[model samples]
Target: MTNAAVDDAMLAMREIFPETPLQLNEHLSRRFGADIWLKREDLSPVRSYKIRGAFNFLRKAIATAGSGRVFVCASAGNHAQGFAFVCRHFEVHGVVFMPVTTPQQKIDKTRMFGGEFITIRLVGDIFDQCYAAARTYVEETGGMLVPPFDHADIIEGQATVAAEIAAQLPEGVTPDLVIMPVGGGGLSSGMTGYLGPRLGDDAFLMVEPQGAPSLKQSLIAGHAVTLAKVDNFVDGAAVARIGELNFAALSRFPESQVMAVPENAICVTITEMLNIEGVVLEPAGALSLTALASLDPAAVRGKTVVAVVSGGNFDFERLPDVKERAMRFAGLKKYFILRLAQRPGALRDFLNLLGDEDDIARFEYLKKSARNFGSILIGIETARPENFAALLQRFETAGLGYEDITDNEILANLII
Candidate 1:
C-alpha cells in the first residue's frame, strides 16, 4: 500500500488513541546544536509504537472475522503488550506466546494490559521456539497470527508513526533529517516509505544494534542474510535477519544512510537519558539518539531533525547492568586480573598504587596458586576516564603484572 493510505489509516487510528506528542527536546538540541524533535511513541497507551501496528492489524482482522475471533502473537517484549492492549480494546480473545525465560515484569505488564481478554502461554526457552509454537497454535485453532513485523499489515500499521510526524510538523518546519531505530524493520520501513520521496535533500538515518545489523548486511549483500548469532543486549531491536517485506520497503535507501550503534555505546545513551534527563528509554528507543552523538555536527547544525524514540518498556532490574555497561563504554571503569604476591604487605602495597579518584568497586581473589601468589579479579572506578591511563602507568612502574579484562567478553561472561 502507498504511504498516503498508511497516513489515512493513522488518521482513523486517532479515533482510538491520540497521536503521540512530537515535542522539541531542549537538552538534546542544545547538546547537538540542532533543532531536535522527538517523536514520542514511548508515550503511547502501551508505552510503545508497537500498538500502532497491533491496532491496525487487529482492526483489519476484526472487519474480516467479526468480533470474538481469536488472535495470537509471539513476543516477549513491547509487541506482546501492544497486541494485548489491542485485544483488550477490541474485546477479542488473544493468546500471547512468550519465552518461558521472559522476565516476570514483562509478563506481568502484558497480563495487566490484556486483563480478561488475553491468555498467556509461556512456551519454549527463547523467542524462536515460542514463535514456532505460536504459529502452530494459530494453525490448529484457526486464529490470526499478528506477527511482530515481516507482514504488510504490520508495516502499514507501523507507518502511522510517519503519518503523525508529517502532520505534527509546524508550518515552515521541515526536517533536515529523520533518525529511526530498526528492529525487524517495521518502523523504519513504514517511516521511510512515507517520508522518503517527500523529503528531497533531507536525510534519513537508520540505526541498528552493531550485533544485529541485519538491514545493513542485507543492503550490502543485495539480499537478506541471517546472522549466525546475534547479541540480545538490545533485546527489542536484535533481530537476526531483516523482515522480507520490511527490507523491500527499505531497499531504496543507500547503504551509507544506515549506522550501527554499538551495544555498549547504547548503554551510555540509555544511562545518560535516564540519569541526566530523567527519561527512561529502552535500548531500541535510545538507538536513534545514540547515533546522534556520532553524526556530523555540520550536517545537522541548526537543522530540524526528528528522532523516533520507539519504546520505553525497560525493566528496572536491568538498571545496574546498564549502568555498568555505560561506565565501561565511557572508559570510567576497568576490570583487571592482578597477579598479587600473597605476602602480608601485598594488599596494602597494591592499594597505595591507586590514584586519589580511583576506588575499588570489586575485589575478589579467584585462586591461590601457591604460598607466593594469588590471582585477584579487581574492578576499579574512577572519576575521570583519563585516570585509568595514569593508574595503569603506576601499575607498570610498580612492576605489577595484570591482565585488563574490561573489554574481554569471554572473561567477563565467565567471571563478571
Candidate 2:
C-alpha cells in the first residue's frame, strides 16, 4: 500500500540478486517514434520477477510464523523455480507439485534451484488436478501453502519490481506509459498498485495471451471470471482465472487499459527480439513488447514508454518450433489438406502447381487405401502470402479439391 514497505522488500531482495536493469531500447524507440525503455525483469536471478513475490511471502511468513514449517506450492513454470530458489535461500523445506507432462527442462531447473531444500511431486496430467493434490498434501501435513499469486505478501513482493523501476528510469525522465503483462494478475496488480497513484493522467496498459483472457473477461463481467479452458503455449501467462486479490487490485481500471495478444503474435515478437535485438524472451515476456506494435503511433510519439520484459526462461530446444509458429503467424507459411487423384502423376501435378517462391515444407499421404483418391496433408512456406492465391487457383484449374487449415485451431492442434 505504501512505497516504504515496497522499498523494504526491494532492499531485502538485494541479498539474493541485484536490481534488474531498466535499459533504453533504441530499436523500439526508433520503430515507434517514442522514448521506449524496457524494464528487463527477464534478467532476474530466476529469469522472472516471480522470485520477488515468492521470496517476500516466505520471508515474512517465516519471520512471523517461525521457521519450523514445510512450504508447498503447485506450479510447472516460473513460480516453481522462484519458490524452489527461495526455499534454498531461506534454508527451509519446500514441496513443489507439477503436472506429469511438465517438461524435463523445467523440472531440472526447479531441482537445481532448490538443491536439497525442496521435494518435487509429479501428479495428474493437468494443473487443476495437480493443484488439488497440493492442497490435500498441505491439509494432511499442515504444510504452508505458498500460492503463486493473490496473497497480500506476494503482491507486496511483486510490487518491488515497480519500486525498482521507479529508481532505475533515467534521471528526471518520468515514464508516460508503463505497459505490463498479466498472468494470474500478480505482476499487473503489483505494478498498478505501486505506479498508478503516481501517474496522474499518464497511461498504464496490460497485455495477456488471447487464449487466456481472464483479466479482460473479469473486467468486462465486473467480477473475477474463470475460463473453461486455456491454451498453455504461453505457459507463464496462461492462467484460467485471475486471482481474487489480483483482480481486486486491477478492477479500478477501465476495460480499455487491457489488451489481448494472440499466442502466435507473441511468438513472432519472441522471434524478432531474439533475431534482431539478440534478446531472448519467453512468450509471456514478449506480451508487453508486442503490444507496442499494435498501439497507434499518435499515442506513443514523443512519449516516454516503459514495457516490462517479464521473463527470459526460454528453452533452446523449442527454437525450431518457435520459428515455425512465428512464420505461420506472419502469413509466410500455411498448411492444407489436398484431395489428390490416386494417379501416378497426380503428386507431380500438385508439385508443379506451386509458385516459384513456394517451397514444400511437409508432404504426407493420409487414407492411402482409398482406391480412387488419396488425402495429402501438405505444408508450404512462401516469401509472400499472396503467392497462396495463385497456387490455389492452379489447384482449382486442375480440378483438385483442398481445404486450408492455416488458421484452424482445432486442426492445427491435432496435426501441426
Residue lDDT tens for model 1, 294-398: 788887888899999998888888899999999999999999999999889999999999999999999999888667899999999999999999999999999
lDDT per residue, candidate 2, 122-199, as tens digits?
Answer: 999999999999999999999999999989899999999999989987679898999999999988888888888788
Task: Name the lDDT of candidate 2.
Answer: 0.92
**lDDT scores of the candidates, listed in order:** 0.92, 0.92
Judged by lDDT against the true structure, how good is candidate 1? 0.92
Give per-candidate clash totals. Answer: 0, 0
Q: Kindly give the stretch of ten consecutive residues in candidate 1 with the minimal lDDT sum.
A: 194-203
TM values, all candidates: 0.97, 0.95
